[model samples]
Target: MKVIRARSAGFCWGVERAIEIAREYATQGKRPVFTDGPLIHNSQMMERLEAEGIREVGDYLSQTSLEFGLTDAEKQRAVMVVRAHGISPERRGYLKQLGMKFRDATCPDVGSIAGRIKLHARKGYTTVIFGDPKHPEVIGLMGYTEGRGHVISTEKDIDFLPPLEDKICMVSQSTMFTFDFERLAQYLRQRYPGALVFNTICGATRERQSDVLVLAKQGAEAIVVIGGRHSANTVKLAALVEKQKLPCYHVETAAELDLEQLGQYKVIGVTAGASTPGFLIDEACEKLAST
Candidate 1:
């Protein structure tokens, strides 16, 4: 069996920045701090953070040691973090209403698109967001404006879009495909002229797609996309591989790989999510090779 790892696999710029910020804060004695989410999609990273004094808080209203859990006393002492996935603007206001101290660790690229939405909206352009509606990133972006905005998973989702009397501003989640988002943007323009599109998909997403596409093109018998099942970006990469008709497995860990499946392929290409760690990739490689 031959195992080839995608050159552009694993942690992206945003994940790196978020983790670094958490570590920096922890080092400064910010013990019992609460993150809005796991900080990233990877369980290993979450466990590591828990060991370092950072507590995980999936929801602000949860019973965890977050701002929500903090009595009036702890709210004045402990910190509340907006994770990389970010919280909605409404959520931010609600947090404020709770009188919590928050440190926004949203990626700069993500923040830029949200800022631009405000700018373009001021210029009379309606905004269209490309992503799963349930995604935290999308939820956060949507909170940025109370104006007219539409969310779409495909161009067909916009087939019934209202006539553009003014203008259109289309943006995407940072983990979406550049090519797909552009194609969707072009479709919207064909249907509605005077529409503006911003490719908010991050540079890291493009690299991961490009690397996996190259692996698929090289005739790899099977591909393993490693990431959390809930991770939208990682799932998107897996979908990209599937378009090639190659056998692909989207697994969170090496333990998830089936030995029976390995028998069907000789060349296996491995790729991982932005939140995935290097060691997870290495473990998958070793397990896949051994099988």
Candidate 2:
């Protein structure tokens, strides 16, 4: 079997920087250092970090606990690391209020999006974000609005607003696919001619998605999408591959791929999330090729 890997698979610039920062923090051998969530969306990557003594905090899906800040026993000693997804301005301020050593590992792309959101909010434009309402990046973006904006998770939610009257600014979570954002933005502009739209989808995501299709078109028989299940961008990429009627497995590690499933394909395509590391993709591809 010939294994084909997406050239875009693996760590993005932001993810690489975040991991490097975390490694530096881990080398310090700090106590009870915690990421607000899994620093990235890949469970395999998170396990590797945990094995290195870096602990994970709240569940990435629906976990929002300020316990890291409130634990009296761990208060002054614990080092809290903000994940790459970043946190709300309020959450960051609260984390600081606890008087604990803190490490910020928010991806630069996300920070830039948050800055744009903040800028729009400060300019008196009621912000509207495109993404899951509960997602950390969306939550962080919403925080800049200071309770003045709304989050539209799906296209149907677009119609929920009344006839547009207030100055509105529309931006997206950094990790969302460009197609989805574009479709929604196009519709919103048609519905309300004055809606200000900002495209915040990271360039890496755009390139990765475009390249995944290219790999599939090159006759990849089976596809391996390596990333945490809760990773929106990863899931979307896998879904896109599936739409091409190719067999795709969304997994965090190579162990999850059954020998039988892999054996069924002659050309296996590999892809990953922005937060995924190159080592993980390489391991999976090596296993597939060896089989």
Q: For model 1, give the 10-residue run with minimal summed lDDT.
A: 60-69
Residue 164 lDDT, candidate 2, scale 0-100: 54
TM-scores of the candidates in the order shown? 0.90, 0.90
lDDT of each: 0.81, 0.81
Tens-digit lDDT track for model 2 on 147-178? Answer: 67788867678889655565788999887878
Please give, for residues 1-291, the per-residue lDDT of candidate 1 as tens digits: 788899989999888888777777676566456778778888877887888877777653355533355687767766667778777677777655666666878888888878988787777778899987877788778766556778898877989777656577889988887878888988988887777778888888889989998887776788999998878888988998898788889998888889796768889999998889888899999998887
What's the number of clashes in each of the models?
0, 0
Clashing pairs in 2: none
